[model samples]
Target: MKLSSLRFFKEIVFAACLAVLAVGESPAKVLTPDFVDLAEKLKPTVVNISTTKTLTPQFRMRRQPSPFPDPFQDFFEHFFEEMPRRPQRERSLGSGFIISKQGFIITNNHVIAGADEIKVRLSDGREFKAEVKGSDEKLDLALIKIDAKENLPVAELGDSAQIKVGEWVMAIGNPFGLAQTVTAGIVSATGRVIGSGPYDDFIQTDASINPGNSGGPLFNAEGKVIGINTAIVAGGQGIGFAIPVNMAKDVLPQLEEKGKVTRGWLGVTMQPMSPELAKSFGLEGEKGALITDVVKDGPAANAGLRSGDIILEFDGKKINEMSELPRLVAAEPIGKAVKIKVLREGKPREFTVSVGRLAESGDENNQKTAGDAFGLSARELTKDLAARLGLKESRGVVVTGVKQGSIAELGGFQSGDIILEIGDKAVATVMDYEKLIKEYGKGDVVRFLLRRGDSNYYLALRIE
Candidate 1:
């Protein structure tokens, strides 16, 4: 063969090898996704929310010089019922997402909390008046409906329970009134509790969530919303919190059906079982919810659950943390029987408890009442009082009024505190408390066990 022919053959072989290497080797790295297409597809589902609130003037605007003299000014001010008083209308802006093609939108409860009128604007520049369907302040979630007279785009809610930390997530909202803004970041953390409420399982992320982003949706890579951007820590950069979509899914149906969420009540206040508490209780592991108080005649009480019992498991699920118990109990079916395992008196015990529907907390009087001997007025802790004070049970006498500068007030006794015990003796009734106090005279130091807002502590008072 000629030299030219041999060279052409080598070139052909090299070209073939290059084609095979190209098939085996991967392409250049794309650090991030091309969010342009995804943003365009998701923007239509996101909406901008503007609300108007009506406020009445607290002080009358300076009155113009009246024709009458100053002596008649007092009479005119009191008698003028229909003065030209201007009612102030305050406007606020936020973000929301369409959950249904029929115009059902979801946003933060705070956004539309006191709004007299709520308006929703779409990416297409169309606006519509929205009606609040339901709201849950505890979760900071609200659902509103709008009549756009056309088929609207809907965003799918993803299973937030399956989301992992460091996963890429997108937040779409009207941040700082800039409508339909999109920001991306990875999930910085999960199950974060920033002291918002009892159900404070927030997904912490680095996404730029601002004031208007309160109601916006946090989406996964698949374009599905896994969380709702609800809060941002002040003076922090790239630190934001979102309510997991799984939590919202749990209460959304109830909100839509009953206009409120009905949580299952175990009637027991609880705290984390610390390592020290676990060792003291003869437990091997630092896992369980330490029961502080048991509501009298409530589900737990009727089930033989006591205040000192440490809950290890509920409804076949393990209670690894204190916060886990609330979410588990709240997810329980109302009126359904569930098995609860507890460690009482350093022994494992189990009981079957019937869940009860949570009732609304009522207002209690905040004035001083009776007990001049102790410089405090006390009453039986009623169910309403327990609910109002966030107590687990109505098992003891509650301090209704604490006289200032008195021994009770000086000893740190406050109104709404439930007196559980006096120096190792249980005081369930007002008579019991009075009798216990009668045993302690002046110059005596009495230790009182008290329950206040889901916490239990002992206070010592030196009788004067």
Candidate 2:
């Protein structure tokens, strides 16, 4: 080999060895958080809550005829009807965290709902009686107070909006009657809806939460309270949900002052936009909420929002999902004017609407039958029928019955479903439904807007 070539080969070997040394010196560090200090620092802020409820049993008069005749039967029935029933006591356990030095604490509304008595136990083993100051059933949040006579340790509140997926979180609670248990895990997801209620934004974590852990605190790495442990999936391991601290913070003042929550109402029944519905409306993608029904003289109607308009934005926030709009609207101040952007006839339009207070009521009625083509029978909705069916408006045809193994059944149609619109046109009566059904022939696809229970959605049916 030539001398110069030998020299060049040595230089290359030296460079490769240097590269290997550099790589060996800089390996990534896997950090495992030591939660002992964090847990100890925050445990004093957490409390174990126990609730007691009294259930009174009622005796009812029996209508059945007794074997004894006349006077004897009447005497026996009177004796049984006048018998005194015992009042049973029900006890439940939960957890909470102190929020203020003035003895204010935050817990789940369900934890102390209908509770006749409540007790709180601190980490120092001191116990005190608690009284519910205020509660909001919609948000499932409760504010309670205790006369501790001394300053209490309070947990620092953190911004849940800053929380990222895969971040370390610690949950401290009394799970299954065990007090002051600490569990650690990472955030699995955010903004999860488990069909719990209308505003169901939950933080998903793998932190072991159980029955007794309800109303506990979920702490971030800095030992700040980020979420309130609220729910768990039945029979599912490592899946627990917490209410974001931000949402709780938003209503805490109202709960403390009013003892209830007052939400703003948009007065529109909406359904999620699907790709098929978007295409039918000449849109390329499904990114907005489709209005099924607008309450007459309500906020949306007053703002000129009509059925078939797709809501693109509420206030200043873009609505990416149908569920987001309700939460956004509910959080707005009542009587406040807000801008709503919508797509109408493939064109973008905006409206300013004054929000109204939500007034919830229930009832719905219906009769006439059109069956055979769709394998379902439907009738015109009447005001009396609407009230009976728990509907607020009488503006649709109600499904009377569905055929077995038919298109209606296969398409998730059930008896008692209110058909609000057929093929983007409102079906106010059985005559309207019949007229719309005739417009679509065999092989044509049609979309039906329906209200089942408190939810609204679209179902597509293809003519045979």
Candidate 3:
């Protein structure tokens, strides 16, 4: 109970308390000063977009009588009679950023897709009626213009190509109709393909992007717009996708001048170069798209490109995967001759191809018939069959039927599949396939190149 002892106990208690507090608190991340300032400056440029769409309902008519007695039957029929549903008006909310002081804004195509009226509200409580100037559904991008007399704050679009993973980013949007909601996170990855579209090079981030965040601006550290918030993985947390600003910049001129997107076509069907395929071809690395079938008389065909060639580069840009090829070719100007490098028989070759406008129906096809040696029945592909199969050229023989429990069926051969090649030799007719089959004796395994729908793969079938 002495004064000296009491003071020592109090000091000990204070030291224990400090130790507990230190363990509970972790080191905080030091944010750059620009983050807060950039977000505040960019807020005015981001706007909330509301769209209204009127949809009409379609009703089906019933002519069959009701199963009931006379008077009751008439009442039942009346009750069951198909009544036309009234038209309904749907309202949706999204977000966008002004690209120009003249009231030009950029957003997602789906935001104003079928809207009859679009209203844009700014942070300053000002509202304006907007009209869609252009949109590209493939890229899911839209450009709209509003007649605003007031000078609007514009957000600068930055180079997304220069952005690196783990860099800080911010997303500003009207998530769930909550206007001007801001979320911050780091770039988790780049060039992500979620299979949402053909050109699906998305910037994946951990930003808290939810419903209604689509069409918003994803800002870089400099407060510049680097991406357009587009999608999020369903039922996933901390996963969101944005369209890179570079892609938007490349297609902006086409959208502004043509009101739609036009892409250059090489007229070739391709698949990713798998490790097995790469090893078979004696390649050191797998980094290109394997050409499955080439469209006859198409740009690639005219340029001397053939099936089984692996496209290494397009227009001097290295193609790392099969998906990258489509985006690269699409971005090229139509009719422009571009240099393409391909690996054929393990040797690299370069060619200059005059790019052609991509046709909506561009797909490759081939045909031939086996002589019952493999228990498979097939016939040469005709123009009609090719068209029905959505094929560009009639080159392969279509499998008519595969005998059950037979070698062909056991080898995964199916009806409606076109056989393009037999052991590196192209099969263009029934005789070609029959001659190839005759060359194979009993118990001999041969690799067959087959086309099913738009995809191509090689299968090995052993002759019985």
Best by TM-score: 2
Tens-digit per-residue lDDT, 134-171, candidate 1 = 88876889999999888999999999999989888899
Give the RMSD in angstroms, all C-alphas superposed, for model 2: 12.7
Tens digits of per-residue lDDT, candidate 2, 80-142, equal 678888889999999999999999999999999989999999999999999999987768889
Ranking by lDDT: 2, 1, 3
Residue lDDT tens for model 3, 131-218: 9888987789999989998778999999999989988899999999998999999999998866455687889999899989999999
For candidate 1, the 10 contiguous residues with the lowest summed lDDT are: 361-370
Question: What RMSD does each model have against the real structure?
Answer: 12.5, 12.7, 14.1
How displaced is residue 177 in candidate 1, in Å? 1.1
Task: Return whichever of 2 and 3 wins on lDDT.
Answer: 2
Candidate 3, residue 392: lDDT: 61
- What residue pairs clash in candidate 1, if any at all? 295-393
Of candidates 3 and 2, the better by TM-score: 2
User: What is the number of residue pairs that collide in model 2?
Assistant: 13
